[model samples]
Target: MDIRTLQEELVQYSKTIGIDKIGFASASPFIELKERLVRQQELGYQSGFEEPDLDKRTNPELVLPQAKSIIAIALAYPSKLKDAPRSTRSERRGIFCRASWGQDYHDVLRDRLRKLEAFLQERVPTCKVKSMVDTGELSDRAVAERAGIGWSGKNCAIITPEFGSYVYLGEMITDLPFIPDKPIEDNCGTCTKCIDACPTGALIQGGQLDSNKCIAFITQTKGFIADQYREKIGNRLYGCDTCQLVCPENKGKDFHFHEEMEPDPEVVKPVLKPLLSMSNREFKERFGSISGSWRGKKPIQRNAIIALAHYKDQSAIDELKKVLIEDPRPVMRGTAAWAIGKIDGESSQEILLNAKNKEKDQDVLNEIEKGLQLITR
Candidate 1:
């Protein structure tokens, strides 16, 4: 196979697909991935599936019976106007992560990759092509590093000089053989900013992440968090950006813009009042198209009450009381009870006591008591 000739065509194809960077590498198997997977399993970070042998994902012999090259591409999620704090709920704001601030990259990348693969197959009818995004068993970042796209940061993110670590990575595993680019040296230095700013210690060690300890995981958790972590969740109802914010490599980068992911002007500051009164139908209508909408409304609704509690807003008392009494979800009731305790003074205690006395649900009573403790203490 004329590998160099194909590389040239493929690189240009990637650019035409809107990818900012592209590189090629030999299809060798990963050796370190095993240890990492073992560690993730031990740390209880495995996504409910045991790691199958790494070979199935990284080894060309297994990935594509004749796989000889891996093509990696990066899309810059640059921000244009992100330096400002999230605007108030009444004002238009762009609080999305640099990556998600625009149209869904998954849709963009998958469509483009399919197009590129089709272009290749039209010329080489027998060639095989498979494309994925953080998908399957392959080490996406490892492939990018070996392909000479960029060096890996200590935070476990791949970083390019022009785009920092805010790029989404995807790959095309093909049957054509290509000369692989050499890997780059690490440029993370001694920076510990990402580690220090991680509110939940997601970054436990070099290139190691305990996703369970990850705020992103917590906020997106499918089930209820243990009550212990609830108090620490703060006002954040969706995703957490603390670690990314503190990364030096991300400094001075442009703010990525996209109209779809722009923070809803009505919820930019993520206030508690509008949230407290939202019915399930209203919650669906408001956040239906956004990323956080997938988990449904319980987590955000629970988080709303937590924020109201921390803010100690007396104005939120009546609305919170309504949720505490009317919301079917016990989790929301618990959090709303806490918010009422924080906002209401002496009389609020009486309300909670009355609810506790009348409430038949053990969970609701427990939530009421938790709120009582918050105020009493």
Candidate 2:
């Protein structure tokens, strides 16, 4: 079969299989991305979740020796939740960002890539293919942008005019030389809304992020979040969508294309108090399937405490106190202490004092001291 004809067939087949967009790009070194990545490293802007090897990351040849073309795919995910649960004064809720709304995107995208690979293998028996989703060394955004799936927006997301930025990207490197698609024009001209709206100023400049200041990255960390960012984190349990939310392109762009991408309101926006005491089994049973739960329960629970504090929900004090005293993780206990301080300051004085007396962990003790100070002040 002709490579271009096969590419056309693959594009059509992709739509039948739930791929919202598909494009092809030359499997060449990402020269500009390499320099930008080097700059990001020198400035310490990386989130540390990316593949560390720059050589393999920028050069398709390094990832797949015989790579001739790269096929990029995008699957549109739901940006809006139906029947969304509200965070009441009594039952304060913490939110998982839209990116983690339904099923773990890693699993969903991988499934699509697997199907694409299978389709290619069936058509061209000798075709060599290497496929990857977000976790892969290759930058999904870079490949997607090059393939005309979207233009890389100032918010550092691939912004498709069709789906807005509400899409999951994946790619497959193949030996077949498919005709590459023309790159998309930059549609985010003069738009600084995403940059201006970042609560913590994590969007340092257009298309560059200081991951250290990013709430999305912070929420996934195991350690206690720094004092400065804790307040800015607001009610987010996992990830931050401030950049996307502020983008004009994402306005009124909600697609419920895939059933698995549909969000369960209660799961994505759960009551903050119960999360404080949720057992590992309970957390896994409740939230294990979602992408937000990948860092496990500690971060979520910690963020829940912070969210409760952000609301100053006195109703959650008892739960916060319980977490401060009994949670085995120092980060959790410490964060709970801070939340208690923020919530019931004067009223939580005794609780903070008592925890300070018995807490052996220096970090937890420090947090307990901060709690006491909050009460006294």
Candidate 3:
């Protein structure tokens, strides 16, 4: 059983099957990552979406007993949207981050992992294997860094020399003692572009992120967006690309290797007003295929309302007013009330006042009051 030969064969097979990059890593406990995660947890910097158990997240052996090596894979996604529809005042649009541009990368990466698993099982009939994508307990970036797939960038993304930071990452843990690849050298030297470009200053210094302030995290929350960050979120409906978009390492790095990763301009940057009133069925039928729709329509619609306000598109006033008056969700109704005031339309004051009188939710009433204040101010 020549593990080195097997590793080489796996690497070659990965490339043949559309994996942009693959590297082997020792499946030892991630010591540094555990410490960092502990600090992040202590500071309340972690996004609640992560697997909560620290030991489970850091120790590979817990996930797969006798885990000896890990295989990390990267699949490049298109950063640039080709032939994107223009956003005009009459038809304002909100942008979904490049990550959610195409078919959910989770599905795309999971399919690749399944293929790799099949290939490995056929070669090593008795060896055990386990795989995970972003949703898994293991940190994909940590595995990728250890596997030499890429260096960890200041934006907290695994930056490959060939694909920049615009790559989806996944890993497979197995009881195969494949030689580990050398970790890549960090290339972010004194470059504060990503940190500076962060609209909400989510990137605290370099590599550290306060998820509470991250627009990417904020866009996923199914509740009222804090007033301070609402304006900063701008037209982002899901996730934020400011950090990656500003990185020098990512310059001229755009890959369209996978057809499934291509962005449909209309879906990724849909008209803002239409999204405000979309039924669940309509929203799913249009956006269910994309990763951004995982949080459902509430957050997207809330951000859409904020986007309309960002544009100060008075034309959306009628739709926003309807949401404020008729929407069942308090978050939707409240956000609409806030957006209406932010827009400061000719009839915004009157509409907000009427909603204020009839609104039962305390939160909605407070938002109505804020809207009234915005109009008078």
State TM-scores per candidate: 0.85, 0.98, 0.99
- Alpha-carbon deviation at 157 in model 3, angstroms: 0.9
Candidate 1 vs. true structure, TM-score? 0.85
Residues 89-173, candidate 3, lDDT per residue (tens digit)?
Answer: 7999999999998999999999999999999889999989999999998999999999999999889899999999999999999
lDDT of 3 at 236: 92
Better of 1 and 3 by TM-score: 3
Determine the backbone clash count of candidate 1: 6
Q: Whose TM-score is higher: candidate 2's or candidate 3's?
A: 3
Worst lDDT 10-window in candidate 2? 368-377
Compute the lDDT of residue 155 as modeled in candidate 1. 75
Q: How many residue pairs clash per model? A: 6, 0, 0
Ranking by TM-score: 3, 2, 1
Give, for candidate 3, the lowest lDDT window spanning 10 residues.
368-377
Off by over 4 Å in 2: none
Clashing pairs in 1: 78-255, 78-256, 79-254, 79-255, 79-256, 80-255
Tens digits of per-residue lDDT for model 1, 165-243: 8777888888887778888788888888888777777788767877777766676665546576666677777767676
The candidate scoring highest on lDDT is: 3
Q: Tell me the spans in candidate 3 whose CA falls farther than 4 Å from its real position.
A: none
